[model samples]
Target: MDWKTITQIDRRYLYIILFIFVSIPLLSPLNLPILVGEHAQAMYDTTETLSAGDIVVCSFDFGPATIPENRPQAKGFLFQARELGLRVVATAFWASGGPLGEDILRDVYGSDFPAIPEYGTDVVYLGYIPGNEVGMQTFGDDTWTAKGTDHYGTPMADIPLMQDTRAAEDLSLWCEITSGTPGEQQVIQFVQGRHGGPAALPLVVGSTAVSVPGMMPFYAAGQIVGILNGLSGAGEYESLLAGAYGYPTELLAPLDAQSVAHVIVILFIIAGNISYVLTRSSGGKEK
Candidate 1:
């Protein structure tokens, strides 16, 4: 093809090709092997260390826009927690996160796993609280005081899971699945900061790709124990869940699609470079 044609390839054609590259994997996943990152492994290890009956406070800090990336990490964490017989006290700093947590719990309990525990006793949803950072501080001081009722409006005193759990100090671990601020920072300031000495609550985070860079410093400093970043992180967590607990690999279709899509984009860049070089070389020969 001429230099102009090679360089000015129709955008429509590129979109079509991109669509195919992304869609084929969704339809029939390649099941490509993913090298799990240290962050995800750390998350797994941190979770595995929790003993049964330990109180884990999970904060769904992201809105629906980030569900694709955040949901899998939520499922992976919850699955591990449930399998290990951990008591999960779920809440949300963001208003929307409450229902999202509820949906996650419903899916997990409704799944084929027969041994999954019931909601109130094993898992409790505290729903959303207002006042952002201030609300986080309130929860850190006293969970029932901040959220008087569960998502269903039942008094916290009536919930079986809330009977003994009262504040951040009672939590064995804190897991935050977030896409924005008032996430790791708030958790650190209110929850982790309030606890005395070296016995601070351990925290793990699952964040969107856009927010992962900012959270790395905390991970490095050991303020946050583990991180699950974007879709790739979710995929790695999924792989861990499958290998560790025998969950289905088919659940990783999004991860497979992501891998193929990335490869396709990289290939396109290489092809474009090759075409440009060849076109220039041909022009030089003709001259």
Candidate 2:
């Protein structure tokens, strides 16, 4: 093999190699070493501190396109909340987020949840609230006014979980599993701290990796108490929770695919750079 060719490998070959590397990990998880970050730890701590009977509101600001990145986060939070005996209120800003939130909860709770609901009393899903920021603000002020009924078409007053839990003031924490606009930013703007501004209602975020840089400012300023970033962050969080709860971590194994893809890209970059330097030293001739 010509060493200089490393810098000039066919793009198709690169694509094929990358496909195999990514697919292999998916088919057979490598279970790569995942170092839990401070943000994911903070997220865990936020949920850990909440007392039983305290209500935790989760805003699903994501959609089907972002399932892989956001679903694990929902699992971690919902499972912890269930074990802690805490109540949860699920709502969504994006149009598609409502059903996804319900599905995520059902996966954690039981297939019977919200549908045949053996676990229905403690959890209420408000479903898709319209008008994005306006809807979030209204719900924060008075939960029933924003949407009289839930995703299942049950009136808010009829749902056991919603009977007394109106407004953010009654809740203990705000957690958002978010993707793009009208997400955490909108919550920060309209819905945060409706309980009382003495201290802004505590916020925890679970966001796509691409959204991490944007969320850092709020996290730094303490507007967000914790964050779960992208798929890797989800896996890290699963590991932490598994340590505490002894539950199986489904994400960490599958996460090897994403991790392998990243590592493969980095390796290619390094190899190409080395080849470029060698080519220059050899007067631009292939060896």
Residue 256 alpha-carbon offset, candidate 2, angstroms: 1.7
Off by over 4 Å in 2: 3-8, 115-120, 193-200, 278-287
Query: In model 1, which regions exceed 4 Å deviation?
Result: 3-7, 111-117, 197-199, 271-287
Largest TM-score belongs to which candidate? 2
| lDDT of each residue in 101-172, candidate 2, tens digit only | 888888887888766553447788888999888888998888889999978888877788888678878888
* Per-model CA lDDT versus the true structure: 0.83, 0.84
Compose the digit string of candidate 1's lDDT tens values, residues 1-287: 45435556877887898888888878987777788999999999999998999999888898899999998888888888989999998888998887787788777777532234577788887888887999999998988889899877889888888987888888899999899867988888887888741156988999898889988788877889899989899888888888889966544678777877788889878777777787676674312
What is the total number of backbone clashes in candidate 2? 0
